[model samples]
Target: MFLVTGATGNVGAEPVRGPDAPVPDGARPVLGGLDDPGTLAGARDAGVRHVVLVSGGSAALADMSDPISRSLTLSERAVRDSGMAWTLLRPRAFMSNAPRWAPRLRAGDTVRVPFPDAPAACVDPRDVAAVAARSLVGRDPRGRVHELTGPHPRDQLAVLAEMLGRDLRCVGLTDGQARAEMERTLPAEYVDAIVRPDVQEVTGRPPRTFRQWAPAHAGAFR
Candidate 1:
């Protein structure tokens, strides 16, 4: 049986299946969180031999000082020591995050956000899930860490503008303002994510670009 952590997250929410059928039977859903290691005890006792963990790139960039990085690092460590085969997927950013701009886009063409000029090679969550599925059901990527990213880095606002068929503008937030806004939800950590071939290496195809992702999720922005 396969045990997937963060199953409701952007990456883990994507279903993983084999050629014959879906693994673990879709009817059963396990409630768990990384904050507590005891939650995994149920799955481990149930004879689950493989675990797929969705860590972040920040874990590789920062040390234990940063809470976000510290959490991801600890999660990765927990999976590694669990004695079950594990795959750690560290995706830079998710294209799905584009939806966060929906309200502003709906209100007007101008969107204000932190790090407007910051280059991010964000990956589609589906691509991350594909690699995870391959590792879970197909191959044993045990004790391996895959840093995933999209095919290219481009202006996400531009892509949204093109997809929504409207003139969109971006107003960059001041560093202090950005930090305050970001800290409301997460500890702000700036990472200039670069493109990686790990997605292609694992899934045998290039990761989807923002342009490709934009069209599919255009409904959210509209």
Candidate 2:
């Protein structure tokens, strides 16, 4: 059996809900995080031969310091040391994150964000799931780390323009400005990490531009 942890998160949801979704076919859903030791053990007891761990960006790890990092790191170690075949997927900046700017998208055509020029190639949750499924069922994926992303890189303003069906101005902010504006809106660490180059390296391809991703998800902004 293939066991997937973090089965309800941005990355995990695709496998749980997609057309060829992984969870329903003898695949077990194990809630993730350092706090959930039982969920991990239960999957192991279920005779799961392969495990896939979906982790958020290193920023979240860096922001929380060693606690969250150690927890996820330990979890990865446990799966690997358990003698079960495993694949570790670390994804940066989610394309679905566009929704967080929904209110702003409605307030005006301009979408402002920190690092508007930093250029992130965010990954689609569906693609992340596809990679995870491949790791679970395919050979040679064990012990490998897959850093996933979309097909291109884009900033928030560009993404907003695509969502609004017209030209939208992008206003870039410094880290300090972003923190002041977004701290109450999102986790500070998460906001800080979205613009890193690591987001591009893992997927081996540029992530999808917001122009491509926004139309389908426009309802979130509307």
Candidate 3:
């Protein structure tokens, strides 16, 4: 049976069919996180044969010196060595990240955020999940890496401005400032984010763009 770790997460939640996916029979819970290779043994004993891992774009950077990259790299290795069929998904930042500007936007028309000048080909987590579901349900792409992305690179701040129908102003933070703000929630690992056709090649459709995603989730920003 297929077992998706982080099933409640952004990408994983999508494949489980919106709010949640039904856990397969005999699915045993693992105590330690992905960083703990010992946890993987539970899946094999639970009758799981395939593992679809949702890594990050940083893994594509291949810099072991970076802790995020190192941890993801180690997790991938554990999955590979686990002897179970595995597929690795490395997706760029998610369109859902746009909603993070909500609190600032709601407070006022001006928003100060990190990396205002940076653009990302931010993907819809649903698309990432679509690819994962295919890999889990099918036999192809086994032991392969799918670098997922949206249709194009975009200025996320500008997109939010248009979506919220406000003359939103962005105060771009310096590298040091950006690092300080970002490090609060996640470790900093910068990479050259790019768009990929893997989503279309696998799902036979174009990946959703931020334009498409923004409107559907505009309520969050509003």
Candidate 4:
């Protein structure tokens, strides 16, 4: 059997379970997180053979001092030492996260957001899941770091305008202003984590576009 940890979207895990917590018993586990001893111990005790980590795909590019990147680095190290087959997925930003702007889009003709001009090869979650599945099924996908990305790239302004089919406007926010607004609820590191980089291709098939994803979930905008 296969167990997927931090089974949310493209995200990280904060293992808080104490070292004495119940050890997970399974044949295969997609262990996520390196900071928590319980999770690692659980995986080891469970007799797990194959493990996959859902780490920040491109977060490796960040500076070593960056906590997020540092944590991922630690995770990679722990997984390597686990003596189990491991697959690390490094997927870029998720197109699914675009819906975060739905409220602004519905409020007015202009959607106020940060990084208006940045282009992202925002990948579809489906593609990421597919790759994980392939790795989980033991297709000889061990000891590999896969950098997943969208098939193409597009700026938010163009994507929103096209999807809404109106003269939607994009209001860019200054770095400081954006930070202040975001920090009201989110940590500064999370605010800085929002990066968009264009990708040229996908591993297996053509990835979906924001143009495609946005319309399909148009109900969210309304």
Best of the candidates, TM-score: 1
TM per candidate: 0.81, 0.70, 0.79, 0.69
In the range 143-200, model 2's lDDT, one tens digit per residue, is 7766555544556566566556776776778867766776643443355443433334
RMSD of 2: 5.0
Candidate 2 regions with alpha-carbon error over 4 angstroms: 19-38, 59-67, 175-209
Query: Between 2 and 4, whose TM-score is larger?
Result: 2
Candidate number with the higher TM-score (1 or 2): 1
Residues 43-103 of candidate 3: C-alpha lDDT, one tens digit per residue: 6766778888888766655568888877888888888888788888888778898777788
By TM-score: ranked, best first: 1, 3, 2, 4
For model 3, the superposed segments whose C-alpha errors exceed 4 Å read: 19-32, 61-65, 113-118, 173-191
Pick the winner on lDDT between candidates 2 and 4: 4
The lowest-lDDT stretch of 10 consecutive residues in candidate 2 is 194-203
lDDT of 1 by residue, 49-100 (tens): 8888888876775478778888998888887777677788888778888899
Instruction: Order the candidate numbers by lDDT, best to worst.
Output: 1, 3, 4, 2
Residue 65 of candidate 3: its Cα lDDT?
A: 80
lDDT of each: 0.76, 0.61, 0.75, 0.62
